[model samples]
Target: MGAFGVALILGLNALVGYDLLHQREETLARAREDSAAMALVLEQHATDSLSGVAKILAGVVEVLAVRADAWERGDADVFALLRRQATLSPLIRAILVVSADGKLIHDTQTLEPAGIDLSDRDYLMAHRDRLVPGGANAVFVGNPVRGRTSNTWFISMSRRLEAPDGRFAGVLVAVMEPMAFRSFYQTLPLSGDAVVTLYHADGPVIARFPDHDSHIGLSAHHLPLFTTLLKQARAGTELLDSAGDGPRRILSYRASAEMPLAVTVSSSRDAVLVPWWSKAMTLAVADLAGTLVLAAMTLALLCEAGRRERAMADLQDSERALRDSQQRLIQDIAARHRIEAELIAAKQVSDAANRAKTQFLANMSHELRTPLNAVIGFAEALESGIFGQMSAKQTEYVGDIRKSGQHLLSLINDILDTTKIESGKYVLHQEDLPVDDLIGECLRQMGPLAVEKGVTLTAALPGSLPILHADARAVRQILLNLLSNAVKFTPPGGRIVVEADRVARSLRLRVSDTGIGIPAIELDQVMEPFHQVDNSHTRRYAGTGLGLPLVKSLVELQDGRFVLSSVLGRGTTATVLFPPSRLRNRSEPLRALKRAQPAPV
Candidate 1:
């Protein structure tokens, strides 16, 4: 067939979808009626099971009430008749008749309801309003305890009986086996693959037909069909449509007059879709086969046409390749221009860094002059008594002024030292020094500040550690900056532990603290110049944050690597590892000592 004819047939095929859903809905509706009628039939059996027991058992109660009344009125002949009535029935576990005068007049099955307050019995009390015709039809079945009427707790029914004048005389109460009522569920026809659910009208599953016990006594918790049926005021079947991926189930129900329960039957969407789907699939396969045949014939013509077309395309492609080669040469020239632009950008960055370095040096010079002037001026004032008589506060404040000046001077020197290191103009003063003593010296400078903060300062340098091929002054400065910050951040009672050991050709000095540690993300930023973590509040702690950055640069100057590792809120550990002096000749220790150190007091 041509294209239009095939499309027409396909459109006709699409029209079958409605008939399919209609046939499906109708077929499902028929199935529902059969099932519903079956439900109705089963419902009658259930009613028969309940009502039949009511009639036969009610007759037993009627007979017992008559003889028990005779016994209460002192008629011995009628008492013998009641004995026959009670002992004759086997399903009746027990029988008792209580009189209006609060006396248990008769009993059978070895137990007698005598000398007990029958007036207090639920049967007697419930029957007191029996002047109304037909009395209340609601019945209660309970298990009463054996032997005592007041201590009663066994499964039995209490039904109100009437006198011939419709007077409330007594009650007809029957004690039946607990299993008798449960037999209704057992005798119903439940498909082995299907489930039969008996639930409380309030929607708790009371029982299930088959095992697995899935629904038994469960709060019908939010089953969609169960909820929907409650909203609707009738009994009907719903086949959940699944073509749009909604619920794919079939449900039907019967509301229980016994309780608020609705019994629902659910079937898989696949089960219902099976018949029509097969029919549609057969048509689909025919259409696909026809389509494949058309495609094959069309493909044969297309391939023949493409063969001639490819020859022309090959000739054109050869000509285009030559033109493209020439075009690529011009594009390469443009790419070279981009590379040159990138170089210019890099040169600008280098120039900016150079200008920053110059500004930093000017700042350091100014920083150095202020501290030197203070120390000189404060010492001169103290020696000459320029501020008149000196009290403790006067002497103390001057000492602080001088001390502050020196500390600023020391920081300024570290900045200058880092500048030299970066310029490749810095020299290492390698020495045959006791690495343990150098480590001890660093700890001694840091201990008082640590003690002031209540931080424990300790060291674990091996006594026989090898000498390092490092500038001892640079090492000390680096350790000072690291330990100062460690103790500064460490809260009161925290510990700062300095540990070192020679590993093969390298000596590793590690300064660790129990402090509010560096954030892992921010640790890399700490080595950048002028960086501080929360500098606004750190005014309480001395030193610009340049200390660690300076230490990093100094360590790198001697071909040593400095690494920092920290767990946030716990502590930081800064480690410096350098090659040992044993690896360098004595003559290699060049003169490079510009930073001044205050003598150990």
Candidate 2:
């Protein structure tokens, strides 16, 4: 009886505790919803206020652009017009017209002359330097600054005033007092620890509730909230530690669509849980009283001895189950460890095999080149009669030997270059070289091959081309490889063109061929070394398939970009874009090329 009573009481306690916990969750959820709603209201208010201020500034700019003489002479009519616009919104502190040189020409605040130079002010300078376009119906918001005369903190927004001819004339300024926002936020039912912040797109805190002068002009760009604003989420919620005050809070933020700013409303986490805590305490006390009553009723009337026996059996069964689970977990961990060890050993073996292959290729390159060079040298001597050849058959045989040796050497060189590029040991010699002359040289070298293949090769160059600060040899090689492939794959009656044109921030060289073009699905594979396009049209062409891949690597070494596009049976266009930093003017003097640092192996 006693054991049964104890179990019943314990179960009752657990049920009550769970119910209370569920209620606590529901209360907290409601509070969070309320906070989000209030934040939304605040966000809308801020957006409307700033948007109104921007519209007023736009109107002021229009007026200033038309009546420049009246404003320059400090006309009363202009001052009255500015005063009326400033008084329309309580958020605005002052409206002034400043000249191109940053001298205050007219003011709605006061007529007294105060020596103020705003040329160095960020907002004014931003307009002067053309950082923001003039007369775009857009406003430029500046960081918060303290007024010298009033000693009050203010954030300013301005619009550029342009002349009739679209030249910059001056700026129309509208200063907003942060205190006005603070005063409005004070009416909201927010806790003392709660914080409200407004961030300019450029990272400064433009306004804060429960306003602090020290925080207004500070940059909060490092905060997670600021970064979130940069991503331009319309309205979202997160829990973060406050940037100014270090309280963890549930912050709801919204970004302005019409202005370059964001607003965040944060509430303390502790305050949100206050109602839940109160309800939990009440439920806990009631549960304890009920448990005591129920336990007392069954204390003496329950079956104690039999209940104890069954409880002992259950405890034993639970222990056995726990032991089995632990054993299974241990076996699983051991199997995982073995698999990991095998994977590591396999990776090491694979790496070793790759190293061996590289070493063999390097050795074979030297071995083959040595004999090939000797064979070619001797054949050239016999063909030129330097070895005193007597018969016509000997002359023809010598010619064949020379051509065979040269072909073998070219194949070996291509393999070596591919190896070097793959091993990351490629180097470049960069210099100022005429782009036009480079194109001409490549054409001259490929002229005979083009004629033999019956392909029309031509250069489409602009009248004057910019010189490039690049590796002359690498540039020549890239052109040679591209031209060679074009002439090789193109049909006898096909056309190949080498074109150069200037693009924004880069110089582009395009080699287009009216040959059997590559299929769209196989474009990516064509840039892989030793992989050719798999199609009937490409089967007849003979190549080692390293030309395009080598060209890509060489262009990248010079800090350039390579782009390839092709449509089957239409054409293939290969473009090399060298960055503008590598472009030199036509008059640039020739200088020695700088050797590029060898790529890391």
Candidate 3:
């Protein structure tokens, strides 16, 4: 009986000890996962911010490449452009154009050239000295420094500007404030003693959440993160002691592949182990009570051997319950793993189906266009008497065929364009297009159809309009689609008007028509691809419903806005507003505008 009591005590101690260790490991694993997730979120935020700054610098470089003389001369238009670019994102503190000799030529903050010289700045020096390996165009990210103009700390993302002859002209710098990053970090839902930090590859901390002011601009080279972990991998998690006898922490980090930046999320070891410690204490107390009970049972057994059988049976029952509990835990874990696997598989299948659908639409559209074009060509030939003279009835039938073929072709083209845009394969060919010419071309193409439908078409233009920097074909398509829909829906003798004017900072183009307008509830649905306001089989209008949606997509792709408003049985108006960035300076010279003939009222 004494030997059995001793064995039972040893077994209970082993089981409790094992459970505590397992729980400790599980707590640490969860902490590692949480830190890693937070690190990824922070890393993406840093990447986006840096990428925006880089894009601004690249745009500045491109501008300088073409208008180097104007930029150097502090042209007002160039200054205004710089200011507009700066306002694009809150992350950008300023956009500066530095001369080859390091003189501050101009910045977005002022139109006049500043007397400040930035020759000593690392970003300018790096460009001037050709320190970047990508030659004149490589973007350089410099350490945080106090801005000469703003008198605040900012990090610089700069690119080397080049002359028309490919000579080094100067440096185009975009100033980014660290406070913007810190503000964003503060918004994250972080738990106790967890710190989120942004670091430059050069070892200096750029920003930190929970406000570590002293660490900013300070090198972290002494830490294993810089000395060992960063050298080993671009991303990883580790358990390490914090600096200067601070609490030990589990740190997860990720480095941006496109920029020399890293994000770290760290949680203190004690905070992560809090739940495990509580559980351990409770478990320890329970083990102590059980040990005391077992000791008393041993004493009772020595005096009364009959009680030993009962005690042994109770011990066996407890062991059986523990085994059953462990089996249930294993089964639950397995079920959870299976659920996760199924979810992943479902997502992959959905993505593949979407890709397949897009590809099918693209392929089928192209296939149909080839044969349909031949049919339209032959029909046009017959109508034009290229083959021979035909009877009047035959001529009318050929015209019908030609018209039907053209309509089908248009639908196919819309389908192809929609697929291309959805798949991100469409590229914009932007140029300086006169708004008047774009409107006139679209109006001329759409005029005949409107006239045949007995709908009067007219244009309302301001005295002068700014040149639109956009893809000419896309703008033309947008106008044509709007006008075509107007003509199709308008009753005979109804009027359709095209209007253009400068509204605030945007250029607005509106097409208003006295047509069978859509219901208020269906206006939003009409903007969806292939979604017709009248989708019933007996609908009066004949359309594939791609027109307005295509126009909206094209306008938005150029950073513009599209709005459609209508009232049932009254009228509908389609409005496209191009952003200021897409419009040339109003003061710049433009071609003479031609007034369109007025329609009969």
The candidate scoring highest on TM-score is 3
Q: Candidate 1's C-alpha lDDT?
A: 0.62
Worst 10 residues of 1 by lDDT: 592-601
Compared with the true structure, model 3 gives a TM-score of: 0.54
Q: After best superposition, candidate 2 residue 124: deviation in angstroms?
A: 1.5
Worst 10 residues of 2 by lDDT: 592-601
- Which digits, one per residue and each the tens of the lDDT, describe model 1 over residues 332-442? 999999999999999999999997886688567666777598676876589457878788787787778776776777767766776666666667777555566666677
Q: Can you give the TM-score per candidate against the true fold?
A: 0.38, 0.48, 0.54
> Runs in model 2 with CA error above 4 Å?
1-4, 133-135, 228-232, 300-601
TM-score for candidate 1, residues paired by index: 0.38
Model 1 misplaced regions, further than 4 Å:
1-356, 359-377, 380-389, 535-542, 580-601
Identify the candidate with maximal lDDT. 3
Q: Rate the local accuracy (lDDT) of all candidates.
A: 0.62, 0.79, 0.85
The true-versus-predicted C-alpha distance at residue 105 of model 3, in Å, is 16
Candidate 3 pairs with clashing backbones: none
